[model samples]
Target: MDHQTEVNVGGPRMRPVQERSDHTALVVGDFLYVWGGYRSISGEEIFFPSDEICIYDMRSGEWQTRPMEGDIPPSLSGTCGSYLNGSMYIFGGCNDNGHSNQMYCVNLLGEKYIWKNFTEGVESRPTPRDKHSCWVYKDSIIYFGGYGCKQIRDVHPNSFTIDEASWAVIGNALFRFWGWNNEVHVYDPCSNTWTEPHTTGSSPTPRAAHASATLGSRGYVCGGMENMMMDLHYLDLESWTWTNIVSQSAVPQGRSWHTLTAFSPSSLFLFGGLNLFCEPLSDGWVFDLETAEWRQFQHPHQDKPRLWHTACLGLDSDVVIFGGSRDYRMLMDTIAVLRFPSLGHCSDVLIFQTQPYSLLRLCEDCIGKNAEILEKQLSILPLKLLEPIQKRISFFRTAVQTDKKITCT
Candidate 1:
């Protein structure tokens, strides 16, 4: 019910010459850890993979570059990851050569956070792929749909059926036949085993550069190419059924390479992707998992297109979008905070006093600033404090009208 918009929290004032796109950034406590992504310059078709890791400190509001230790991962793009048990597990990504099935993990809470390869121990694994979706369910990391190790057919636009029309039409080829991977693989760290779960009902088609977020036992996925799909699908992990959620709400445009961060554990915020025209997008949308609705957020940064970037739900349900490529322009360093409505973060600024006037004045200030979610803050306020805040709001409105009349005379 509370609201916030994207605000650029500038960081990494000085960036390295090597920029990247299609990377992943994760939030662990107050820091955001960024990993490998490919870079595309304006003229060249060349893609340079980043081997280093960048850390953005929320407390300092700056970015730090760190060298990868232990066995380092190669420059990769369209990679996916999940953090659990004090360690982050990284799966498939595409390098300069091709997609990789390699898996690795880094312990953030350990004495020394180092990367360790675990792919050799797993006998069965998902094929080398990139632009896949990954989410944590219980203790297991579930991997689904991305480009796989298969020969792809580049068919003309005229050949694809209407249902599969939205799939990525890369260059002259309207449909990529084989590269669209539709398989689902689940890895259990407890057993170090990979298993393909049996999924029933309807499921999503092969896709790449899509995003997924876990809400309790259920997993929701949306927007990707191979079919530039706009439909939202949820998997009731308990029943192992994929239900294509049909919402009365105006769904977002079918996009690829977007970021979805779970806000407030139950709600989700989606941001930035390339649309059907292959143009980069900057618009943001909020989706309620319970109601199956999508509402576009009104933000000042509507013109700042972002794609192939990483966004994470940070301190107090605030969604942060950072480090993306705008068209071919590389944006490897930038921090944006989508502040959600929450009193938890408000404590830093709001000083609660015995007098309700203090809180009332704060409410009036928020209203003066044209903050849309002023009403939402009331629900979280103590019952005893509500009356004073409401009274103060009414008095302020009346004062404003009187001032307007005096000016008119």
Candidate 2:
């Protein structure tokens, strides 16, 4: 096993350490909220403090730390979450103690944010687990797969339970360390109830550290840590069925802790993870939903290995990958912005005819004159597109007002 030791990477102001893995990052409006995850210092695993919230401005490429005020959960990593309505719903993660089955929500709309526990009195819920994946389908948050204890009750009528052979017995059967679970659990915030919906067809094997993303009415899952999986499957929210995508080429290999991000209606972006050999990966690929095909694409961070990282579709559908480990021994505090070509975006255009100051002034004047019209036009765009574009526009407005030379590439 590779050893881990903490480095003082948080700098002088001493905010929360960004060198983490298994943390959750979700872009809400103009900011990316990152929470949970852990790092090691002197061989001791240390979780990011639960008292502070880490946020990144999509427009500024800057980080902000704010005090967390709410029914805060313990510091945890391997937790999965989704942004819904005005709140961010978090479920299942592990800490020093053990895995958790609890569900909590933090309202981001309020001036004073408070974390609210939702599963406190719920008699039925998913088992305590970490490294699971969750998807927000309409009003419900659906989660699947993680390393946790066995489920005492049926999560679904036909919940794909773990096989007997997978369980590990310790101390003459005095205790049992459970294996991975492939069960799917759904939490409906409208009724505040948990239900397991029955589905047809084959499901992915019990696995953890998988990547999931939602597109339209389907939730797609790909590549996880059950001996490292390369298979891809998606659960149709409309039909409640699992459909597998078997491609002989162009797809990523067996890997874990990668990110699957749905950038467009017909495409998904996949990035860095740990391969079956437990080695960090740097390659990226795009999966086309319409054609059921995968294609390898070069990214800016192609040479930088990363696993246990969190990625979010940022401004103009750029994939923003935040803190994760480069290897088993070294975690990172860097953020890489990858603008994928699969989103039908034009290649970086270069301008050679104009002086920097004059071009900047032209842009500033145009934006200033059309500010109201721009706002009205952007109002009708979807949040995924609108938020990022607004951020970009704001960034452009700020950039043009400064003396810095603006270049696009």
* Deviation from native of the Cα of residue 264 in model 1, angstroms: 2.4
Give the local distance difference test score of model 1. Answer: 0.62
Error of 2 at 280 (Å): 0.4
Each candidate's lDDT (Cα)? Answer: 0.62, 0.68
Candidate 1, residues 345-366, lDDT tens digits: the string is 0000001111123454455445
User: Which ranges of candidate 1 are over 4 A from the true structure?
Assistant: 1-18, 42-51, 151-177, 328-409
Name the Cα RMSD for model 1.
Answer: 12.5
Clash count in backbone of candidate 1: 5
Kindly list the per-residue Cα lDDT of model 2 for residues 346-393, writing each as its tens digit: 111111111123454445445544666677766777786655455456
Report the lDDT of model 1 for residue 306: 74
Error of 1 at 309 (Å): 0.8
Task: Give each model a TM-score.
Answer: 0.70, 0.75
Best TM-score among the predictions, by candidate number: 2
